[model samples]
Target: MSTAPLPDLVKTVIVPARPDRAFAVFVEEVGAWWPLAGFSVGGASSSVAFERDPDGRATHLVETLADRGTAVWGAVTRWDPPHALAFTWHPGERADAATRVEVTFTPDGDATAVVLTHSGWEARADGEGARTRYDTGWELVLKPFAEHAGSSR
Candidate 1:
């Protein structure tokens, strides 16, 4: 396999909600919309959630397996409500091999434009392969998030 550095994978989705509401739903209600069955480190029956600190700040993203075990996907790197959220991403791998995912919510008229940028691929042993999988994976993961966020009041 070639050792070329992969470009950042950027995906954008327009959600029918204000930036504040959109960001809230994305971070707080992620477990409801995230497609755990296909995207989880654990099996199909797993559930994902953001673990918040005592002050209600998100500190880490975790997936709970069917057998009651847990896998820490990543730690929160940036958390600005209604605007941006960023974290390290290494679902089944070591934290040292984690990539970075930064998502921004921009107000667009009556809706919000949510942009996700996945970078830092070179940290992983299979950076190119992982980037390829996540390119398509983010599409599937975001579809449900858009739908669920749109329907939320």
Candidate 2:
């Protein structure tokens, strides 16, 4: 048993694009930007998608396998356009077994300050390890998002 407290991971990047564009590229084009090689439940070659409904509602973030099967990585809990998005994040795990990930796109002059905060690890059984892992994990995941946001502008 460990007495280490669960931690909240926060990472921020200044995207060259505006707030709306940064948010758009981050949420809408996730399949193109998210690195699937090392971070997917669909294995190394899997493709990921941030699926949204016709009504501007985010449905699921899923990973598609080479064999065409799918893994539900998370569900969108908040979908505020061009500003903020919050979701449950626990790929290949039960829906209830999830942590909360919230990202905010703040307008910073001509650029957007994209802040990502992952929390709720206190509820996880593997709290300490998971907290430490995602401390590094989000940096890997969001690196491409920053690049894409810059390039798409």
TM of each candidate vs. truth: 0.95, 0.92
Candidate 1 positional error at 91, Å: 0.4
Clashing pairs in 1: none
On TM-score, the leading prediction is 1
Candidates' C-alpha lDDT: 0.93, 0.84
Global local distance difference test of model 1: 0.93
lDDT of 2 by residue, 79-110 (tens): 89889999898897777778899999999999
Q: Per-candidate RMSD vs. true structure? A: 1.5, 1.9
TM-score of 2: 0.92
In angstroms, give how far residue 52 of model 2 lies from its true place.
1.9
- lDDT value for candidate 2? 0.84
CA lDDT, candidate 1, residue 107: 98
